[model samples]
Target: MTTTTPDMAPVRLYGAEHAADPERSYELLRAQGPVALAEAAPGFVVHLVTDYRAALDLLHDTETWSKDTRPWQSRVPESSSISQPTQWRPNVIFADGENHAHLRRVITDCFGLLDPHEVRTLTFRHADTLLSAFADAGTVDLVAQYATQLPLMVFNSLFGMPDEYGPRLVEMLAAMVGSDPARAGEGAQAFGAYLAGLYETKAAQRGDDLTSWFIDHPNGLDREEATQQILLTLGAGNEPTANLIANTCVRMLSDDRYFGTLTTGSLPVQHAIDDALWNDSPVANYSFHTARRDVTFHGTRIPAGAPVMISYAAANTCPHQGVPADGFRSGNKAHLAFAAGPHACPARDLALLIATAAIERLATYLPDITLAVPVEELTYKEGTIHRTLTALPARFTPLAPDADGATPWSRSSADRGSAGSPRTAPQTGAMASAP
Candidate 1:
């Protein structure tokens, strides 16, 4: 979707139906035109940037499309507030230019500075508990047992919260996942309250966790402000990480060929993780931005104050955009799973490390953990903002290492190699193999 009054190249974007399937969705829009105006919500129309170069140009040049919360408020306005939009100013995420730079710097060192030792320690700790529960059980849902536990633990420990709070955070995050941003205010309120509680406890004392960092650092937020940030992170961070790992598992189990590639690859499973982000975006759409100025994309004109959406899912999958033509190529991991340019996720490094370690270890631990469920049966909770997958049930025969692949349990033919009852999990294919 080009924003040139007539200066540069035209912008490329997709249509509405592609909201759920952005990659495919953008293709149709790009085919329709380089720039397509899309109705993302009621009385809202955004110019989709389907073309790669154009998307790159616009995302980086914040001068043109700013993330300033004052200029353009999000339809899902997740502010660091006790109440809704009118109640408070924007959070760190909404800041632009120097403001964004300064706030981002507080945690700038945190991502890269995240010690591998920490990741190793937490992964093993959570894995021990999770796998023990599934031990000897012929058919266990890996997503529930393995995939979900690791990242939440990583986030909780990193944030310095107790294990008791982890379940509550995960539960609250599930509530916000697919709810409309406007209607999700209640979730936001509950999250704010939770963060306030956390802030009060951490304010009294200090520790090495992120909460303590925020409390002590001059550049960081005060306990109350930090609490809001924590709430936002918990709500946003939990599911994306969970979905990335679970979705990867589904991708890997779907095809033996892909699984075999992972197994034998000299490189680590990082690329495979990228493939999951591009192929199946966990956060499907980031929508409903009010246009700050008069801008015309393609022939369709959008006056100032129009709602625009930057569809990262659609952008990554477009042939003309990111990733090489060969989707399976190991080097095509530069997909836009973590948004792009100015708004690129600060947690990119940490998130990737966590996902890679989780998936790599998973493929190593349970090569026989195939999907026990079908694709269509998998239900996704959808709202104007995201695509949140609820349950991924799979029946797999956790046979001995020598049991070969897809063992059929005894007693129940479907349960396989006998031990547990038949279960269901939506099969999205497995993401990690041996690579």
Candidate 2:
């Protein structure tokens, strides 16, 4: 008798001595080979697809790796406290086959119609107003003042609401999902309740904003369903976007050459985004998935019904086969901060545009703007799913104009925000000891 079994061993992402760094964790997986078996639970298992090529193989292979995990009631309960089997709201990303495709199409039509040129224009106008507020101020917290506030303001129009709600929503969602799962679930529930109220209000009017189409869809969406979709969208859409802008600024500020390239017009808005997407991806993880059937990667066998954590962050940096063919330069690419395959982010187009608009506006207008503190002072937010900044202290002095008599404020620079104590970074030695 000849018998052969795939290699299945214990490989821990987090060693007892050190927390798992995404980059380091991935390299370990790569060294072990493309795919490895992980014990997701005692006596239960899932495949861990760690390498870029193998991940893409599994992600796009819907037949072998299905997203349709029906009969999930006993599996993914709403909350540990709740006796209820499951919440009825599942985003399109969680669905598989035609159902997923259909939902994505409807949502895209509802909110994806913005003209890029107009977005860019709006970004410039908003930047002008925001920059003007802080031009005189020598320093400010970039995250609290600008990064967190901007996308909420920009995306608010899509829903046709007052920018006033953006701050509240941002706060609630921040608590709900960024890193802390338990706290985030609490926040998610609260936000869900608020969304239910808001959707009911919008349904009555059936206005032209996102609510109208979503609420009374000919296809069908009741108050509960509509609320769930909206809640999911808001959570999924905003933070990554805000983080994207914040990340871009952080990366550029780290190196004068990167900033100079943008300010000098060597890089357009889109190019800057591409550079950042590769260098400083914002949302660095996607939800875990399960393999529906037996599959193999690099000769590693994955039995049916196993959970898999696809490393989008790892896949993005693959030297040979990362990103789509068209986007990769030298086939070297950025982090898969967004995942690939079936659950690839649906709002990618909008996120990229919004980010580019922010960058272009800043680069074109505030060429001389510089961070008040050195980039080393920054604390980069990193975790299983999100990457953002706690703060980026910055100061800007607009350039004096030529003989043309053009007011420097009009052509040169614009908005500033949040009159907090100017958040200058402490000196290295001082920062090391304080707090």
Residues 63-174, candidate 1: write the lDDT tens digits. Answer: 6565543433344234322113212234445667777776676666554556777876676556645554565575766656666666776687777778777666655554
TM-score of each: 0.76, 0.74
Tens digits of lDDT, candidate 2, 244-332: 88776765555433554331433333544555676556755445665677666567665666556565555665456434664434223
C-alpha root-mean-square deviation, each candidate: 7.4, 8.1
TM-score for predicted model 1 compared with the true structure: 0.76
Top candidate by TM-score: 1
By summed lDDT, which 10 consecutive residues of candidate 1 come out lowest? 80-89
Q: How many angstroms is residue 214 displaced in model 1 relative to the true structure, after the best TM-score fit?
A: 1.7
